[model samples]
Target: MKNYKSYIIGLIALVGALQSCVKDSYLEEVNPNAVSSDNYWSNLTESEENLTSVYGGLLNQYLWNSEVEALRSDLAFPRERTRPLNYGYEWHSQSFTNTISTHYFKSWNALYRVIWRANQVIDGLNGMDETFKSQERWTTQMAEARFMRGLMHFYAHSTYNHGEIIIRDKIPTSSEEFSKPLSTSEEAIEFFRTDLQFAYDNLPNTQTQKTRVSKGTAATVLGKSYLYTEEYDLAMPLLKDVIEGPYGYSLLTGDDVSLLFTHAGDYNAESILEINYTDQHARLIQTTDSWDEEAYTTRWARYTAPTNLGGGGTSYFVPTSWLTYEYSNEPVNPNDSRNYISGTNIAKSVPLRCAQMIAVVNDEESTYYNKTPGYEATTFSGTVFSHFKKLTNHDIVGHEDEVLSTSWASGKNMIVYRLADVYLMLAECLIQKNDIDGALGYINAIRNRWGLMLLGADDGTGTFNDVTYTKETLMDHLMYLERPLEIGLEGYAERANDLRRWGVTKQRFEALAAKEYNVVNYNYTKADGTTGKGSLIQEGPTVNVKTDVNTEFDDAAVNFIESVHAYLPLPTDEYLYNQEVN
Candidate 1:
């Protein structure tokens, strides 16, 4: 119940040496000369070092990982078909399967590690002198720690809440407590909400460094928490404050938005909270030296979309045919700039060949592949694949191999919260509460900014005009079509959870899987003497790439994925360790 501000001030003033002692029984060895709790909080420098260690622990969490491959598996793979990999192996790819047990365990462990470190910091602060607690620095640090703890819990709940009941109570000192019993989904959510509320109350509006946490970030996260809980009314005002308050955030221009994923202007004004990556400091390294290196390079070149110029390969994250068709079919009046900005305008200059390749793949393939053929050179053939184009750093092209190296750092800040996300959430909430007009206004505000035409009528552009609907159904559709396109891979994990909650993934997949589109061959080979025919072939109205693809969300699939598996299980090991304690 102690307020964050007061707690901070108290710890700062009483800055006594805090020892970081480990139990001899718990570890193989101990450092005799290591700073003990007695000296840890005693001096300013030592206290700061302890805090630094806490920050390092925060970064080690699953949510902060660079590659984020687990996210794709946990969120994207089970829900939608962007590509076909292990998806054909129904048991292996299903979220409920034991195949992903390690992923679930790793995620759980990593988050608990973060929480444990935060708890240490919190305890350290608690043990500090009352006089030092009133200081601004101490207050901010404690608040930040609390916020991080909340964030870790938020992710934990999101991952394990499907049906597997898992929970970790606070920070576990002994290995036993680390593996406590799983909390119910509702309980986990409440725990996260509690931490976020503390963070919101204690954190400041701004921070001196961009890397640090602040009030706006806390509020934004809190709003997201509320949105996830389906408490839209509570979320709306908090999100609005983040957008309109002293946060100093604005939507980046299309060009600037593209630059955001590159290392160009990463920590700019538009960022609310970003997992900061630097070329010099904390570089993203390949997990292994040889295979990972090759995989990384191939993926970079083949998966990402080509840069503004034509020299690079296109590895793009192609929008689904359903998404593309929806956009194309929408009303696009000449007067509406929103439609133009939304999808019509070509903000970046891409090669004609690349564009054509993208169209072909989206139209033809039932399951998207990361690598495909494109324009060919004398020595090398272009492979067209889907990549997060926004995150590409063209400046480091020649040293593309070293792009993931610590030295060749690109400054692509991953945005955790943004203004647009909030607006959409508000709209969703309004619609849920039967506030149709209110919802429309919120949606319109976003569209208006993009120069889109009005929603309900057919614009003469051949695309259907926006159609009005009752609040309930309209909200559902908006979340279905609009949200996916708008947020894309940013909140992909969250989207998957929402789909589960709405019980729509199965239906959505069925509808999309049944549709057909045009497919063309982009791989052209020259004949011995003259120009040869390209490998352009139209496969299907609906191409079935695999004969064994699982179309039905069968009981096997359900069993493989627990209802609680929708949320991540608390690391079984943690609860195992703590069984005696409980």
Candidate 2:
């Protein structure tokens, strides 16, 4: 069992206990028995307890619990064959219509919940006794709260609300305070930097509890914030620090790379920050309140797993044909033995990253949901079909056969930030700075992990594998090649952010829309001695955009208005409630 204790139930019970302390006697001028923030925040224990609640807010539906980020990117498509097409179709197709309003509100609301709780903890910590404030525990907790606040603001600005979000620096005491005006992107990033800088300055290089944020986490995020705003000069130092720092971080290699998504990989050496989940008491009971429901587990697996694989998964989102082709497009390292399909003399197949990412047919080397040797059978055939395997526990155990009664909940922790991402980000920064040679090392470091051919004649062989790169070529490789393969579908809207940042969202989508996809079925013998579709390859009349039932092929090519869709609109509730926003 995971040792890190998430105070999910403890947070709920504590809030209930405190609220019970309210004594509103009609005759009293002031209730001495009241449990206000002033009285309750008497020491470090209270601060620590409240901080845990702030962390709990990360598991919200619009946050880590779902793949809203992936749905928005070209990397994933909503499984249109499944029901409730409205879940991701709007964002996936970039419709941004009245149908998507609730999604916008939920996203805005969830992120702010984290920001508000973080602000509450910060305010409480600030108002505590002076001696307590002087203690090391107080400083550390303050940094943690600040880190969360800045991080959430960054998410709201860059990911969801797109810089039209209000910066909630403190707990609001009145309606006016709560309804503050939106900050410009510059104002928001500046506000976020102060908090993140404090966090980077004060946080330990490493934490006793793997779940807690550390110095490396703060640095990487702070650098990322700068990178997002195009402050490449400002971003370079911080990212470089993470690359060379004594944070004890390194990339997981070989078969161990498969462990990155499993329960056993939680808080591994590569991970900088992770949202921890557990199945010790996984429950199926759903509540109207998002925070109160299944605090120790996530529905990410059930939502992303392949439905046809007999896993009881909803198959809400699956890897796009574009993404699969990108993996296949990667140049195979002929020297490496792992590059080939098992039991096949064919020298090159999809690399290790592709095998780890999605289940493919006739792959005797990889496993899918206890189906050893490969995904030999699935109901999804005749059309090109592949489901996400990265975030789901489809390799370790079948979703239906979990120890818990519920099939929806999973204990695998979500890795929000890891060393590979930092390496890629650093490479991007170096490329932007015109240090093309400087950037190749960071990029090649990732390639070296899979024993793939290095770029730009860096390898001693000097053959260059017929691949030579200039500054422009290297940057192209960084954006389209390195970023997608390594950190593609992993984080919060990572691929979407990259597409937007590179000014290629519309182009990328249209390109994907134009491509044709195909399905190939391998021959296999049944127990009854019947031969299945043997070496049958079917060309798709289907294009990528129409893969999702809700999306029109023309929608991606025509309806994607880059100016409006690139940055999502602020929630309608913001205009409805905030006097200053309108």
Candidate 3:
């Protein structure tokens, strides 16, 4: 129902259909021979093709649909922002049910397809001739395939009905075994750990091809897998190795940072592993008309501030005021310089204007030097909101005629892993292990990289900003804020999982939702069209007319976030076909 055409094609290609015909009575011959299991792993080219097919399986739309969106947004259990239509909010209200049957089927089928392909490749490589035995090449390819398989398992485990779901083993001719009983979360996590560990052990530290996975990439992912499994001790060393490894990766400079989200930066050194997409790449060809455009068409308007002025519209995802306020409330004298406001003021509503005006009066200068024209003193009315500026590159305005083109054509490379993530994950593991000083050291290292003031005693930034956090609470908070801010929309899909894993969805929503005002800053223009300093507006206690504020949050709001919702339901069709197994 959800367009299984591509998936079917991938399966057919990867798992060729075979037919047998009898020629002679004594010695029957096979005719119209389909791909046989015996011949599946015969060579290097075949193995490479299988690996390519595996990666292709992950780009299916069924895996990135409304159900996934609900998992990410605040309308359910993890309310980071207070918007009425947030999927989290809707689920919380019981307005909708998690019946994404089609999506579930697609996700399950595609992952199995990837896993099957990986098995074929692995098997084929094992049987390769001596001439094909380049340890470096074979190991790299195998590692990449394993990483892909592990990533799929991770998603499967994370999304499958709270981790009680079927484990697709190899390829199935019928839906029988595939539709079997669900595995426990612990089982799924173990599978993921094993796969990732294999990848980490075999992958190279660096590669001439940026798109390929390296030792660090695999190690980082293994660390993440361990973190998800709550194996802090196991995760920490792997993460630290990634941080200190010679992957030639580091934080992008102030100027180069903007390039990270664009098409030109795809598969750069900073990117550990990423799903490659290109306007020109055949595998990534998706007709824009079919995909949802909410994110693309408005020039990433919903995600950031307005065009020409910085902020954009709020119909799509908007960062919560609580997040903004946290940044604003950073210890002033010795905060990360990167924490300062930058870029243009695009909040055109009255409430936003009021908040910006207030921020300016409070001396919150623009962090980015360049300001968009015609955004001085402008005010937005409805709910004041904050947005990520990382995706606000102007070159992508209306680049596609279909669902908003957050497409790679806009120069935004989707990062699956990076050094920054590695550092933070290590910090998290250390904290979970009750190594407070060790955790702080890793966190401070990241802070220092961003030119921000360090925390804890002896970092020379004075007392620890008066913020007291137990090891678990502080690590949780750091991951929540830092991951979003650092990764932005690129990792938006994972937010809900992080919230669930930390058991802080309800707490974050409650704490963040009670605030009275949400502020957004943007450059504004006067009646004469002259742009000047951005003014803040307030949006809460009712929508302010002047700023065009349209978002709000209240204390009575309850999150319908369920621990169960963290895992997605197994596809019903699989079970239906395999009723005997069920």
Best-performing candidate as measured by TM-score? 2
* Candidate number with the higher lDDT (1 or 3): 3
For lDDT, candidate 1 versus 2, the one ahead is: 2
Ranking by lDDT: 2, 3, 1
lDDT of 1 by residue, 1-582 (tens): 111232133233321221112232453334464334544676444555555544444332234322233222222222123233343223223444434445445555556656665665676676688776878777777787778777877866665545334444344444444334556667877777787887788888777667667788888888887877788789988878887888777765433443344456566766676555333322323232211211122232222333322223211233333443444343334454322224556321222212322332222211112232222211111222232333333334433334554212233345555666777777887887898877777676555544444465455663334576787667766767667655554542656666666666555555544655432233333323233322222224424332212332332234433354444444444443445323
The estimated TM-scores of all candidates read 0.71, 0.87, 0.72
- Candidate 2's TM-score: 0.87
C-alpha-based local distance difference test score of model 3:
0.51
**What is the C-alpha local distance difference test score of each model?**
0.48, 0.67, 0.51
For model 2, the run of ten residues with the poorest summed lDDT: 16-25
Q: Which pairs of residues collide in candidate 2?
A: none
- Write candidate 2's Cα lDDT for 230-275 as tens digits: 8999888898788789888888877677677776777888999887
Worst 10 residues of 1 by lDDT: 376-385
Q: Give the TM-score of candidate 1.
A: 0.71
Error of 2 at 331 (Å): 2.2
